[model samples]
Target: MDSNSFFWKIQAGTAATPEAVKTLGGKIVRVDAEQGSVETSFEGKRDFTNPTGAIQGGFLAAMLDDTMGPALAATLNEGEFAPTLNLNVSFHRSAVVGPILGKARIVRRGAEIAFLQGELYQADKLIASAVATAVVRKQAKAT
Candidate 1:
């Protein structure tokens, strides 16, 4: 793991994973900075379910956002961060309360922006997919 990589920092416990990610039960599984790709696993808790007992679409969207954001974050230089500008998600099949795998990769990247895509899967079935754009920004230095 490159020390400069944000994902590596999170994995090494040098930096804290966000509370929202914790709520999603997210864990970083693999990262390939050169390839601009990452794999994450999330526990879809029953609390995330809707009236149909399936995971709510909003939670699934958050999972996808968490997935795709890291794909770009892993490649960022130290002291830099990317905030999602827009996320467009499509729900395919309802997901149950269990382990869900997320895979994401950078589709394109420019100096200041990146385009990303990702999918959520459970039991080898696609649960949802998403495309997102993010703008890279330098972290503010503490005064």
Candidate 2:
């Protein structure tokens, strides 16, 4: 596998199932999902920090977006899949290099759209939050 593409393996199974989350020298501590909620954890390492010695803001935003986007996407009915159309994130605090946890839930699911909210936390403190909207598309062709 290519180096950068390795991160694509960080995926959880559909519904309530757990899946392996590939680490770029980091680890996924948890990934639990209920009917409308999904929670995930990621261990931050030195490589994830910016030159300024703190977790980069883009990294924090990616965590929040992934958490929120999937919480809605995973809820699609059979033969359907959802993809993020727009994602907006707001930073409330900086996340240091350490373990960070993120949680998300579907706020609403309309006929063809879904709205979700999620947050990233460091050691139990909120660092950032995100809101996302997705368009439900027909499932892609299976390999």
- Which numbered prediction scores highest in TM-score against the true structure? 1
Query: Candidate 1 — what's its lDDT?
Result: 0.92
Error of 1 at 50 (Å): 0.5
Residue-wise C-alpha lDDT for candidate 2, range 1-143, written one tens digit per residue? 11111122234322332232334222334434346677777766677788888888877777776677556544544466677888888888878888888888888878888888888888778899988888877766689
- What TM-score does candidate 1 reach? 0.96
TM-scores of all candidate predictions against the true structure: 0.96, 0.74
Tens digit of per-residue lDDT, candidate 1, span 34-99: 899999999999999999999999999999999999899888888889999999999999999999
Which stretches in model 1 have alpha-carbon errors above 4 Å?
A: none
Instruction: Show model 2 residue runs off by greater than 4 Å.
Output: 1-34
What local lDDT does model 1 show for residue 87? 95
What overall lDDT goes with each candidate model?
0.92, 0.67
